[model samples]
Target: MNRSARRDGTPDRGRGNPARSASDKRATDKRATDKRATGKKDAPGAGRSGGAPKKPHRGQANTAAVATNKRGKPKQAKPQRQQVEANPTISNAKPARHQYVQSAGPVKLAAGEGMRLQKVLAQAGVASRRAAEELIEQGRVEVDGHIVVEQGLRVDPENAVVRVDGVRVVVKKDLVHIALNKPRGWQSTMSDDLGRPCIGDIVSERVSAGQRLFHVGRLDADTEGLILLTNDGDLAHRLMHPSFEVPKTYLATVNGVVERGLGKTLKAGVELEDGPAKVDAFTLLDVNGKQSLVKVVLHEGRKHIVRRLLEAVGHPVKRLVRTDIGPVALGDGRPGTLRVIGPGEVGALYKAVGL
Candidate 1:
């Protein structure tokens, strides 16, 4: 065994530690000193955690800067705006320029004129809204040299050029709401079956074929009086709905004079096999020795409700005549004769029924 540096100040450089020249030994020592001073590491990924170099943070700069992409390269960004209204702040901002838009709707040729296209055709008494739509589809309506097939298309009236079936239409001056005093022995419908005369027959030349007129309500072939016919559908429906509870007055000719307490029983409420019934008000107006005409005012449109009510009170109705319904009555209206129900008369009926 030989030792390079013995315990004594003597050199034994041989065998295991080969002897080196002075210059070579100096060079080797310089390398070890340089490594210690520069802190050169042995491992390839020295000072790195989990085999990865830590990413540069917001405040930190790159120790070894990488070359950037071209000038056209885009920067990494968050999600982009999705739709027009996504940003409320931008949406609420004022426009940079004045915005003006014109609708392709029906226009009145004259200034200050206001009317819908479908309604203008209907007012001209040509046809109804549905019928007007048909006219448009048939290419009969033209506006400003353009055939308008779209019913939803609106136009300027005065400037707009319109022709229906090649005929110019003028919206009518006014609308009419007329009622007829329906006579008895005739069905309350517009037309009659069983070859019987209808209430429409009694209305005379007032109702034109082009006008859309219908009865507000119906009366049985036997139930006569105040038959209201009008072109107004909304009024007819509201007046007929049971929720309104419109009072209808009737004059019923019963077999016997109603008993003394019979009126009380009716006023109190009488139970029928079908259901209970109540009269708003009742009074025995006449009694001619076992014959009587009882005027019944009730708010019911049930099938044969008046006759059934009389029957429930032990008085079967022989003949029934409706005197009034809601705000109109059959005044001096003969069995088969009719008169126009005036506004004054209608007003009284409204008060009587509290409409």
Candidate 2:
């Protein structure tokens, strides 16, 4: 051995490298620890040390510290699993809310419920809701035969007798729907300011103004036929909305023979000054070499739409008559005719318009 390579009887300096250094340090520490333990054990009478006793590792561990007897089994605890039934009271509880749909009847009302007398009158079929309100304002509506103009007056439904225009109201208990054959020069309006003839004037004396009559839509004062009059506001609203697209059929007489392209123009939808307009159906009613009559139906009720439509296609409407709206049709009733609409007819009218 070279003298420079030997130190303390060792032939060479210890191994060098990460693994060898770590392993050598561990073996050295374990040997030093074992010597300390042996020193303590050799002197059983050694004084209490500042630190704890040396622990026995895997080689000298006490078997009884953590083990069962090798040849015998220890008793195990049995788990208690209790079975419980579901609660019947929670399952049987009633729902908190209920739904209410519109019903045709004398709706039971309470005092101070905020329901108005005219609304009750209208719903009871004494008149159109609008007409009923008008009658109430006119002081024609009476609660228990006393004229009441106070709109906010809430009357007890079961205890009140409502009369309009001196006529006892017998709420028809049915929706009233009528299709009037509107004559030339008669307007489709509840009340006319110019005092010219209106569709109401044409209603029979039996179906008086107090009956809550009203026009469902607008018609030029000169336009004629198949005008709808009804007391069902919901049905009217549905028929008027664009979602329903309720079609109205009309027969128009024009000045000259209209080209087929005119019908096409109407069908394709014309952009009017008001807005875009649509025609669901159109056909030539009659065509003479000089004059022509055409039929057009639309889901929209634009202002003077029939006239505007004919003008868009280069033909001015010399005359116009609404032949149908939804399911109601104008048959052979004379120009000035009027009649009461039956309950079935009203239901059919509502059904036709998809109420």
| Most accurate candidate by TM-score | 2
How many clashes (backbone atoms < 3 Å, residues ≥3 apart in a chain or on different chains) does model 2 have? 3
Candidate 2, residues 265-345, lDDT tens digits: the string is 777789989788868888987887788988888888778988887887778988888887776678789887865554445
Could you estimate the TM-score for every candidate?
A: 0.48, 0.51
Give the per-residue lDDT of model 1 (tens digit) for 22-100: 5556765786787899998544443333666556789975534543347744445569876765655565766779676
* lDDT score of residue 189 within candidate 2: 73
RMSD of 1: 17.0
CA displacement after TM-score superposition, residue 170 of candidate 1 (Å): 21
Instruction: Write down the RMSD of candidate 2 (Cα, Å).
Output: 19.3
Q: Name the regions of candidate 1 deviating beyond 4 angstroms.
A: 1-179, 341-355
For all candidates in order, the CA lDDT equals: 0.65, 0.70
Model 2 clash pairs?
127-211, 127-212, 128-212
